[model samples]
Structure formats: C-alpha cells, structure tokens
Target: MSADTQHSSQFALLRQRRFAPFFWTQFLGAGNDNLFKFAFTVLVTYQLQVSWLPGEMAGLVIGALFILPFLLFSATSGQLADKHDKATLIRGLKLLEVAVMVLAAWGFHAQQVPLLLACIFLMGLQSAVFGPVKYAYLPQHLNERELTGGNGMVEMGTFVAILLGNVAGGLLIAIPEVGARWVAWSCIGLALLGWLASLKVPASPSTDPALVINWNPVSETWRNLKLASESKSVFRSILGISWMWFVGAVFLSQFPAFAKDVLHGDEQVASLLLVVFSVGIATGSLLCETLSRRHVEIGLVPVGAIGMSVFAVDLYFASRGLGGGAAYTLAGFVERAAHWRVMIDLALLAFSAGIYSVPMYALIQLRSPASHRARIIAANNILNALFMIASAVLGGALLQLGLTIPQVFLAVGLLNVVVGFYIFLLVPEYLLRFVALIASRCIYRFKVRGDEHIPVQGAAILVANHVSFVDAILLMAASPRPIVFIMDHRIFRIPVLGWLFKLAKAIPIASQKDDPATYERAFAEAERVLRDGDLLCIFPEGAITRDGTLQEFKGGIMKILEQQPVPVVPVALQNLWGSFFSRIEQGTAMVRPFRRGLFSRVGLVAGAAVAPENVSPAGLRERVEQLLAA
Candidate 1:
C-alpha cells in the first residue's frame, strides 16, 4: 500500500508536485469566482439600490448570469478539455480570469452595472471551461488507488475556498469607503496567484488529441448527455450528483432567510450558519478517504443520504417553533442552549451531503471512458446547473404557497428520502455495497489482506471457506470489485440477506441430488459470468459451517473452472467461528445475537490466483488454509 492511500495521508498530496499546483490553481479560481460575485451582490444590494437591480433581485440576477454560461458553454468546454492538454487550457483560463478581473476592477471603480454583469458572465464562462478539465485531469495523474482520496481533497478544498471567498468578499465590501476598491484588488490578486500556480502544473496530455471541437452548445449538450447515458452507472452517478447539488442549493440559498426569519438572528448569525455548513462539508470530505478505505466505495452514498435526511428533518423540528423575536447577535445566538440543536442539525446535514457527493464524483471519474471523460463531466455540469436552477424554482414555489422556511426544510428532507431510495434501487450496486459496508464496519471489526490479488478487471473465480452466513458480505466489502456469488439456494430464503443477495444477482445453486436442473443452471450461469469478464465467487463448502472447522472443498468449483478456465483466487474468513452468523451453538446460526459482540475481530485473507490447469479442489483448500494460518 502506498503511504498516500492511508488515512490522513491525503494531506500529503499538497506536498506532491503532480497534485499541489493543480490543487492551488483550482482553489484560487473557486475562491475568486465567489469573491467577485458576492462582492458585486453586496454592492448592488447595500451600496447602490438601482431600480432594475433591487436588493431582492440582486442575488437572483447575479446567480442567473453566472450559471447561464455553464448551460451555454459546458459541452464545448468538455470537447476542448479532451482535445488539448489540460495544463495549457488551465493556464489560458487563468489568464482569462486575470483579464476579467481587470475589467471588473474598472467596473467597480466606475460603478458600471452592465460592465459588472458582463464580468460575472465572463467569470462564469471561465469556470465552465475549467470544470471538465478539473475532473478529467485527476484520473490522468492519479491511479485508481488514489482516486478517492484525491477527489476528497479537491471537494474539501473547493467548499473551503467558497466559504473563505464569501467571507472575504462580505468583509472587504463592508469597509467604510474603499470596500469595492479592495474587492477589485483582491480579485485581481487571486487571479494572478492562480495563474502563477497554473504555471507549475505538470502537463496532462490530451486523451483524444484528434477530437473535433463542436462550438454549438445546443446539439453538443444533447450529444454529451447521450454519450454519458450510454454507461448506466456513470449516467446514474451524474444524476445522483446533480440531485445532491439540487438539495444543497435549496439549503444554501435558504440559509439567509432561514436564519433571519426562523432563527431570529442577524446577518452575523446567518454567516455563522454558513461557516458551520462549510466546515461540516469540509470535514466530511476529508473523512471519505478513511471511510472508503482508499477505494471508490459507493457504499457511503446511502449512508450519507440517511444522515442528510435525518438531520434535515431534525433541523425542521429544531427551529420550527422559534417565533418572531429580537434578532440575536452571533454570540447571543450561541448563548441560548436551545439554538445549539439547530447548529448541530445544519452541520451534520452538510457533512452528510459532503459524504454523499465525493464518491459519486469519484465513481464517474473511474467508470467513464478515458477518451470522453471530460465530455461526461461536462454533461454532469450541465445537469448540476439545471438541478440547481430547479431548486431555486422549487424553493420559491413552496414558499409562495405559504409554507414557512422550516416547512420547506421539512419538504426537502422528506423528498430526499424518496429520491435516495429511487436512485439506490435503480443502481443495486450502491445498495449492495452499503450492505457490505454495514457487515464489515458494524457487525465485525473486519480486515482484509492481499485484496490486491482480486483482479481489478477481467474474469476471476473466488473460492472461499464459508464459515458463517455473512461470509460473502465480508468478502464483498474486502474486494473493490463486485462479485457474483454462486450460493446455495437455501440461503436465498433467509429473509433480508436473501433479498439483498437477489438484488446483487447472486446465482443460487441446489444439490444435484435434490435438484439437478438448478445445479446445472448455477454452473452454467457461473461460467457465463466468467466469460463476460466479471468476478464470480463460490463458497465451495456449500453451506455455513456447523462447526468451527474448514469443510472439504467441493467439486462444483472445478466444474465451473473446467468450462471457463479463469484464474481462481483463494480466500479465507478468519476469527468468524464463534460469530452470531456462524452455527456455533446447537448447530444453529444467528440464534444468539452478538455472540461475539459487535465489531468483534474478523478477517479476510485472499491468496494469489492459481492458474486454471494447476487448480484443484484440494489445492485451493490448502491455499485457503495457508492464508487462514498465516
């Protein structure tokens, strides 16, 4: 294992030449984008009350202008990223930012509304162009093992930059006489710093150098969507991420009103709420590497969705009863013990949103074809913009219908429950991974060694000793890739586990003596799985062990291997003999819950794959035995 894959080692990426420069460049760009926009919004809202740009309309117009470019230019931007070196594109984009900032400075000095609006649109264009390159660049540089941690770092940095930028803009634009002037200077400086960082970003060569650019966004956007939709998982991930943005936009756009009306707090308290949210998301982003165990673990998605809904619902209840009262200062808000629950709810909800998003992003990066990765990401951006816009519309409609802000929160939280279930059911892989995660993290203190022996791609047959009912689940958690287990049909009737196995599409086999047709079909299906270059796992012992000993390997595995000739990997489940899932007392399993206590030690050790011709049932058994003993 590389040191960079360890917990907290994601921070070490900041010191690496390949990652640091790109990180800072993107970081500054995000910060500058928010800084410029917020300052302008503040200018229009507080400093100058133009009839065309009322305070109520300032944020809306600025936001619309900013996101408009994404809708118009994302497809073209994606093509550019695929067709040219990303480092070169990044440097050029930074230069554009510098020019935009220079113009913004002039607009601020002269108080030119049209010019400032143009600047917002121009900044948005720059961001649209950079989005595809930003995601596409990471996969080119980082290996699969580093993808999750790297994505976590970027996600964390982007949110942190956004928070800092908003804070800086609000602070500088509030200065007595020189606020706008200071904002202009800061924007320009940040642009220059981003350009400087881009200068050091190593070359990320084009994935498709011969690709033709399509300047028409209308046709290209549709084409991009179709291209992404070709891969169901990748497309669904894009949709899932877009939905997250939808939820986030709803909550974020409401913070000001939620704090002012519901919590009865001043501007300072609203800012405090934003601070908590940003920090919570950043904390959750950094935690992904550890929770995912250095892989693109989609299991965390469901877990995150649960936290998001629970906290959002609780937040509604936490602030529902607070009536109109004296506006509290930041410190005053904190002084009230009743308000702490609101803060906690907001923090945990934001944190859950963070956990929910990073994995989907990573999955998209990993699964999308390399040649069109940027275009798919562009499709994702277009979807995100649309979703966020829909969020604005939805929030407005709900509030217009006389629902209080807290009620809106309640609506979104409940809606999330529906959306989360719909998406997870559509993609059963995510649901199965969640089940595996629960098995490994909650039921057992699970550890896996030699997981690298499991093939990252192509065909492989995994033969393991079945010590307990949950052995396949623990094995699933251990391997990065999904496994199609050939399990006894009898286990398919064990209630919840059976349903999950069916969802996972595990093939069920019966003893040939009792059911010849089912037995033959199982082997044929297992063979077909290997032929299709997917992982197939078989518990050769056939059933959960009645005693704490390795049962003799069965010939069913040999029958499948004889036809498929795929590499067979040996795996052993250790320290599970006395577990609740194991038949340890009176030949019954799961009779005494917590027999080994929660998170009791358990391990999965995978040995190197044995060649097809050299493999035998006895040989595989000995290999698993060696692994268990080791």
Candidate 2:
C-alpha cells in the first residue's frame, strides 16, 4: 500500500496509476455489459413483443445467454491469464468488448434479436476471460493489508455500475423515436471508453509464463477444481462465496415479481428497490476495510451471512400483507411506513451480501498460490455459475408449486442459515474468526498496535502476557492469520471456552510436574504446528494474572525456540486485567457478569521480533513490559 492508502479511504486507490485504470476499465465493462443486456431485454419484452420470445421469458433468456460462456470458457481463460501479461489480456478483452458493442449497435439499429443475442454471449465470454485476470491482478499488485479494501472497492464499484447501467438502459430505451439508436450509441461509447481506460493500465507480469494452453474446457475446468481443492481453505471459501451468489441470485431474480405481485408497486417502485439494494451492497463493501482494521478478515463473513438471513426472513413477514390491489408509485411507496420496512430489509440483505462476498474473495486471493491463482479463481467462477443456475431453478420450482413471492423469500432465507452453518462447519476457520471478532469487537473495544511486526507467513512464536481467560481469543483477533495457542490445560476444561478452543485446534498443556505426558504431547503438537509453518502463540507468563499483575516469565517459549529457531515476537495485553473474563474479582475469573461493563477498551501491542539466539525468558519479558508501558 502507498502512504495515502495506509489508513486512508480506499478511494485513495483511484489517485494511483496502478489501480485506477484497471478499476475504470472494469467499471466500464460491467456497465456496458448490463446496459446492452437490459436495453435488449426491454426491446424484446415491451417493444418488439416477438412471438419466439415471450415477455415473461425475456429476462431469463437474456440472463442465460449472458451466463452461458462462463460455464464453457472459464478454464481456458484462467490459463490464458496465467500464460500472458494480465494488462495485455485486459486490453485485448476491452478491444473485444468494443468489437462486440459495434455488432450490438448494428443489431440494435436493425432490431435483430438473433444478432443481439449473439452479442450477449460474446460479452459474457469477454467478461469470463476478464474474471480471472481481474482477481489475479490484485494480489500481484496490492499487499495483504490492501487486499480486503481493494476487493471491497472493486465489489462496490461493480454493484454501483450494475445499478447505473440498468437505470441508464431503462431510460435510454424508454426514449421516443430513436430509442434503439440511443441504446446502440451508448453501448458503443462505453466500450470505446473501456478500451481507452485499458490503455492506461500498468503491465502486470504473468505468473506462469510458460504454461501450456488447455483447449478442453471440461478437462481443464476439472483440473482447475482439483487444483483449488488441494487447498482446503481456498476451496471451501470458494464454495462459501458461490453459496452467497446463489442466495443473491434467488433474491435478485425475484425482485421484479416481488415488487409487482408482493408490493403492488409500479416500475419506478421496482427501480427504487434496486437502487436501495445496490446502495446497501456498496455500503457494506466499503465497510469491510474499517471493520477488518486493514486485514483480510474472514470474521465479517459470518456476520454478513447472519444479517442476510435475518433481513431476508424479516422481509417475508414485512411484505406478507402488503399487496392487495393498490399500485403505488415510487413516491407513494416511500411515503408509506410499512413499505419502508420492506425497503430497509432489501437494503440490509444486499448489504449483508456485500459483506459476505468481499472477504471470501480476499481470502481466496491471499491464500491461492500465485502461479495458479487465476485458475483457482476460474474454478470459483464455474461454481458461481452453477450455484446461480441452481438458485434460479430451485426458486422457480418453489414458485411453480404456488408459493407466494414472499414465501419463496422466506424459504431461501431459511435455507441460507443451513448453508451458512454447513460451510462454516466445513471450514472451521470462518467460525473461529466469528468468535474472535465477537470477542474483539463486541465483548471488548479491542485494538492492536505494531501488528505489522507479526509475520504474514512462515513459522513464528507469539509470546504474550496472559491477563484473562479469553486472551487467546483476543490474540486471534489481533493477527490476520491463525495462531495455534499452547494454552494451560485447565482453560480447556471451561464449559464453552473449551469447546471453542477445541474447534480452533488449540493445544492444551499441563504443568510438567502434574501431568508429564500431557506436557510432552503439548510440546510435540506445538513443534508440529511451527514446523508446518504455522503461527504458534504461548502465554509465556504461564497463567492468567490473579492479582492483575504480570507473572514470572516462563522458559517454555525458549524451549520451543531452541528446536524451531524461529523469530520470537513479544506481545502485551493491556487493560484486560479487570475485565469480566480476568481473575480480578476475588481472584476468580468469570464470577461476575459485566464486571468492567461491555466494550471496555483493551489492547494488544506487539513489538519487534527477536532473533532466536537473542531470545531469553527475561529479555522477552522486558520487551512485553516495555510494550505494556507504551
């Protein structure tokens, strides 16, 4: 990240050369694609009223046409992205967009539905190729700290562009006399602009320049899926993201019917719903950077999932008695209080969608191997396409059973809960992050300083002062990566805390004198964790403070470092001594609720890493003491 982007708004990316051009190019491409598709759909459904394509099926046909290429060509596209410079691929894709728009312009002017449909497939193909390059290009440029914010901006921009494109298309096609001509010109103009913007995108070098192109879509797509599945976290995160798209597709595809039948609203009212949804997504996307504190935090995923389900289910109840016979205009809809609940529900559901998707994208980018990252993203695209198709099919089937639109909404919302839990259970990291986030953000107003001293990768030992029973949880929140805590065996016996730690795979140790076998087993597990290049944290004070004071530093950390020889980082937990989870009330922890009240300010400060040879029990304690004092 540049100095401007360190803690500043993500918009700072717009002022820089590396990101701005790419952003605009992507923005224009998405806008142009939607503009062209929406305008054509409107023409077929309202203006032409062709016998071959009925008005009711126009949107579905157009959507299917647009999504077809993703299923067929994503594998090849991912390979091309890895085999060639992304900027070059992007520029070529933009030029292809220009050509496709030129054809679309001709189709629009001639009222040639077949030609326009072909252009839709072509546009989808262009977008499909661009997808991998788009995500793969990010990790190559932005650091880990910038990934969440950068992905957030891209997601926000995409949704905003979609909204603007739909609005522009609707308005342009509604023009009198030369409406088709206007749509044609606008599409062509946007394509040209996209190509112009692509010209300024900086060169992004290929990650796998020598890779052979795989022409077989089926086989290559299978290969890509296999590649992604090799990394359990990345593969599961992909599924989580696809499931979100599934939920979103169900909600979005139902909106027109939802507004017309359920809300008894006019076209403008439907547009209002769209505007609200888009704005919500944009707001949620931008919120990730601040919520994650500039890291690729997966914790927000569960929060988003819960909010999505809650608001969606609420929307069903809110709209149950809404539609009878009164068709309300946009202004009338806003004036009604009951309708406002519906609007708020839609906005929050969309917002939760935004929050749900961005971190998963960031996590996928951060974890995927650079050499094959684009391919992994390609696998994700394939899954997304399938999940969306499933959503549409399933939603349609439910409605065909005579279910009301609001009932369909209720079903999907309820289904989301099951899906969210299933994914979280499969990928325990997500659930763990949720717990850590709740502890850090809700239970306490937690903050961290000098967190950059913690390595983003490889083996390292985090030695911290154990001030409370939940210190490990707070420590997990402090760092972007997972930490395998070597905790006292006694803490593992606590009711809910023990279960949580077991889920986190926390290694529990007893005093050597009390249980020598458990002590040795804990050391063996800790060593294995470090040897696997994972972070290992130890409360070197051996126990939580009984008197709100630091205990004598233990030599256990030095014993581990002697074998691993990894850098040892000193960490201090401040203001946690008197908290509810700490042993401050009569030297017993968790005895009284709200002992420090809620959201008490507490902090974890990490100091510079000491070389293995330079680490000692006293020296590390001094560093922790200094950090606590600071």
Q: Tell me model 1's lDDT, rounded to 2 decimals.
A: 0.88
RMSD list, candidates in order = 2.2, 1.7
User: How far does residue 201 in candidate 1 sit from its true spot (Å)?
Assistant: 0.8
Q: Assess every candidate by TM-score.
A: 0.95, 0.96
1-630 in candidate 2: lDDT tens per residue?
455566666888888888999999999998898778767766775578699886545666677777778889999989999999999999999999999999999999999999999999999999999999999999988888888999999999998988888778867886877989999999999999999999999999999999999899999999999999998999999999989888877776566556666787765565677788888998999999999999989999999999999999999999977656778877888888999899899999999999999999999999898999999999999998888777767876786688887898899899999999999999888989999999998889998999989998889999999888888889889998989999888888899999999999999999999999999999899899999999999998888888977778988987797678999999999999888888865688887888779899999999999999999999988999999999
Please write out the lDDT profile of model 1 over residues 1-630, one tens digit for every residue: 454344337788898888999999999999999888877876776578698866544665677778778888999999999999999999999999999999999998888999999999999999999999999999998877788899999999998988888778877887879988999999999999999999999999999999988888999999999999998889999989999988887776666657667888765676677788888998899899899888889999999999999999999899866667788978889998889999999899989998999999999998888999999999999998888778778877887789988898889999999999999999999999999998899878898888878887789999999888888888889887789999999989999999989999999999999999999999889888998888999988878878788888888877887798989999989999988888876888888886667889999889989999999889998999999998
